[model samples]
Target chain A: MKVYRLRIAVQAISFIILIYGGLFYIDMGNRMPTFSCAYVDDRGGGCFLIGFQHMLSRPFGEFLGDAGIRLLKAMGIFALWSIVLNKAWCGWICPFGFLQDMLSKIRSFFDVDLSRFGWITRTRYKSVKYIFLVLLILIPLGIANSFFGLEKIPRDWSVPFCQICPARVILPVFNGDFSQIHIDFSSNTTMVLTTIVMVLVALFFTTAFVKRRFFCSYCPMLALLSLFDKIGLLSLKKNGQRCTRCGNCSRACPMEIREIEEEKVLTNLVTQDCTLCLRCVEVCPEDKALETRFCGIPIFTASQQGFLKRQGLDEESHTNKNGA
Target chain B: MIKTVISCFMALFCLFPALATAKAAQPATFMWLEPMSWDAIRAQRAKKKAAITKVTGGQQEAPNPAESYSTSQDKGKKRAARGARPRSYYLHSGEFPQPDRQQSGRPARMNGQYNHRAKPKKSQTQAILWVKYPDNRSLSFAPKQRGPVSLFSFPAGDGGWYDLFAYHDQGVNNDSRIHRYSYTHFMSHGDSVDKHETNGIEGPGFFKGQPILEIKRLCADDHECYRTHAGQNLRVQVSFKGEPLANQTLTLITEQGWKQSKRTDDHGKVSFLLIKELFPEKIDRRKSENYLLTTEHVLPATGVLNGQPFHHEHHIATLPLQVFPPKSDWQSKRMAYMVGSGTFLLAGGAIAIRRKRQRKAL
Candidate 1:
């Protein structure tokens, strides 16, 4: 539970860093030669996006150009983060997710759809994010391609989220240069639309509002992160026999990972997006039925064996040890 | 020769200051002009021909491959024709510069004519002008939008490769005379290898390809002319407006005395602080013979951009005064006479030596 608190604090800090990325954008994208903050002051001040993008395209060929190279570098950075931190970007730092979480908390809105839909809508639509990522990438290339067979210019590899991303489409329109809206017409339209849509969506699919805990249940990003979860550093274990199903863990689950009922204790194999956002362990009133750890190798209250035995569940940490 | 030289010198002297100060009060951006598809242009011509056919009322027949009005046509048919057709000559079909993109409503062809410094074959026909702006100031090349658009206006090309925009003044007048040295001052953004032509993260050369920007006097066709009459220290200045760049150290030296250096002043103006002092060539000849007088600036451009400031090397034309003492002023103009006489004799002696060598070969 203490770890949960710490994770929240860290998440907030990481959120600040993400905002720094934004400030850096407004900080440096304003100048030209496109992506190079190469000509900066002694402090080397500029956007992380621009500076980092410049670094990537360099090792490759010149066709990418310096600006194009920089953008490619930004992509490499994102991919690296996906491998290292898994889906943590979505959990703690995604500005879109941040907005979603804020909306999910409104106590006033309510809606019950008369139109019924199947659960299959779950896994299918989760694939949309990848499609969105692709769309964002291709649009710019397509435009360049039309002008002078500009097919040679590299695509926007970094911020793959920019393409058809509802987040950007819904918010203030920040230009490629990263300058903020003072009188940006696009920003005004997007702001009004996002606000109106947020209000409407909150009134309708209210459950869709939860944080890293909610839409992430089927988030393609989570699907990707889960693959890396095998080597992840955060996990949770439940003590069944000690589990007086007080409904506490279920109430506390941040990502809404199922916490109760089945006599068998199931460790979330897909915890890459877990972000160790430990709301589950904090609410467990059975004097600790659920516990958190690094890779399910206990670091908190007890070992995995003791908890499984108490639950009368027969599972071994063998596979976790195998790491395959 | 003397008359032509003096005329040229006088022209340089008169026009140099005029160019520096002659910018349009409200300058316009350069927009890309490109032609449409061959099919589209052909279709348009066909439509015009049809119009002419109708106006002629079945009189003169229109040619299929297309032809000039000067070629023999049906005169009696023309009399039968009710309306007269203004003469139209179809240009010979040949390769012309085109933009890569499909027609964006703008027709483009490289207008190297105004570019009096570009090489020959450049002005033969039109191609995409590729109006490349080194910075926003170069934005004049684009059509005036309400303001600057986020879009980059470039030529639409074919194949996999794309063409870049640059306007080189093709050197020659309709008379085929060498282009007048345009003392018409305008900033010349020095060319550098493209980013792709360079390495990433890895900085420029180390003892390999020379690092300095050799000051080149753009020839009639952008040829790099070296060693000249105006002295080697070709007073090169890097400036924004009229203000000189003084802070940065810019060195001009031959490989021999590469040690001497000069820095720009507070006004951002740097003068010739070179190791070798330049001596201008002195020459004299008959009044009407044209002379190929020239000059050189062996400069190397280098310096860290302390901030995000921008700069350019503007080769302001110095007065090409040959100091020809008119026949009226003799005694008082002794220095002019002596220098002019010495130059004429030296030139003659050099010519004589070459002739003697040629005679020996025969």
Candidate 2:
């Protein structure tokens, strides 16, 4: 099977095991560990569980204190997961990422071309995820401060990011539940938060259809994972001496990462914005030019033969030559 | 003859004023008797007669049905006297203001002596404050002079419908000097816990009729109310006349768990602070945080609230403390180390990536 096909299979299985596995335990003897993704909870835990849990749990930042230790313990789980899979979690396993890929396939089936951000906006948008990471950390701290009887923050400000996350409103709809879409009129603040959630959910649907992986550019999780990108085992490598300045890698890129085409040297080609989707590697025509590596081992290598086979052109070319 | 006529007219006018004053002094009268068994009422009469004889300088009067039935003993007492004792009732004459009514206007007065604002009734005395388990076992407490005191009788262990008849006639005494104010609250309380649970005790049930006010806690998490942390919003809804009340002030009291006042929005909902830190003095690590949220609507309580002819709506509901595992010292330390080291690694990785690029360029 193709790598993309294999990735879709993995995404489906993980989504089932993580999202719907709880339904199987009805009337069973022993209960299973829910180990629900901390991200599913607004106060952290899903994939990168450390951010809000640390800020919310701490009494004060001090030497050898209880709060300090708890923060460290919370980060350990994410650290372990990050080291093992790195951005492959985004590339091959994330249900949301797979959903975006599926949307792209649907758009292609309708004969619609994907839209790209202009170079000016693309460069600026690359930093958007870092901005989101900062807000993700800061907003929770503000809430922690409010809890400590500090200046009162708006009630809707609680779970500031998740309240507006498209996934919170969109993901449950796949299971035929639209309850998340309604505004919680419990308070003015909740009404405001739910309103924003609805708007973002609408924007997510429209953008994901026209622009591939539009949300990934500013995903806080992606920014968090990028903090370890240099040390991450998975990498995209480039061969500088392969000659032709063909822009195939950049043109084939879904995220429109220009660095793959702009770089003169052959180092750290896996920049922070790369989702490790390996589309660049798949499109690079030169042999031994572009490679996707796992800890320095090339898992996928680009070549003329592989590219032609992927395009379904090799057999057609052979038939044409025989007929002539 | 003219002097005699003037004197007669003045005397008649004075008599007319005297009659009007006497009529104005009479209070609106009503009575509520606890629906006690006949045997319980007879025992109560006997108890009051002994007390009244002591008060009347040992002069005993024949027991009249009105005198015998009017006196009250602790209603919380069971037939065998095994469970919690009933709270005592104090005799007050004027109408008391409802607990939840905002006190910005004229303060609600009970018997003209107590302001429900300055001297709010203790929550320990609000509503049906006790429950009996299916095995007919219950938590026991000594009888007090004030509080919502009730008896819970259970015969079958299958979580059956238990009858709870509660009534209190405040200010009902043989002493004619004080006005008698009385009211009764009734409900049949029991609903099984779930498909699996056989028998258990639950919270107090809702009042059967309107001017019915309910305080329901809408938690932020699906697990439980107390599992939610402080700073997270806990929405409490108040329904009156089967509709969500709009723009009402409710005292978001948790101080008897965490005391902070809040006003309801257009939805008759108020958000309370869910702080995990205990009040400095009340801090006990072993105990979970508990909250008692109460609100009263002071529009003469429905049915008959006489002497205290004005009804004071009092509603108190409790949410078990939403307590999660507290962060320990080691956990905090581990968090600090992870964050510090993670930052270091991130910084170091960026530098390595830069250095590798430089080496390749050279």
Which is the leading candidate under TM-score?
2
What stretches of model 2 exceed 4 Å from their correct place? A24-45, A49-64, A146-152, A184-189, A315-324, B1-362
Q: Report the error of model 1 at residue B43, Å.
A: 22
Q: Measured by TM-score, how close is model 1 to the native structure?
A: 0.37
User: Please, what are the lDDT tens digits per residue for candidate 2 over residues B193-292?
Assistant: 2343323333223233322455556655443342444455667777764588777665543323235677788888888756554423322223333333
Query: What TM-score does candidate 2 reach?
Result: 0.49
Tens digits of per-residue lDDT for model 1, B49-131? 78878999758655422222222233432232122211111111111111121222333333332333333231332211122
TM-score, each model?
Answer: 0.37, 0.49
The lowest-lDDT stretch of 10 consecutive residues in candidate 1 chain B is B285-294
Please provide TM-scores computed only on chain A for all of the candidate models, following their numbering: 0.49, 0.84
Cα-based lDDT for every prediction: 0.34, 0.52
Stretches of candidate 1 off by over 4 Å are A1-8, A21-88, A106-161, A169-218, A239-244, A259-265, A268-275, A295-324, B1-362
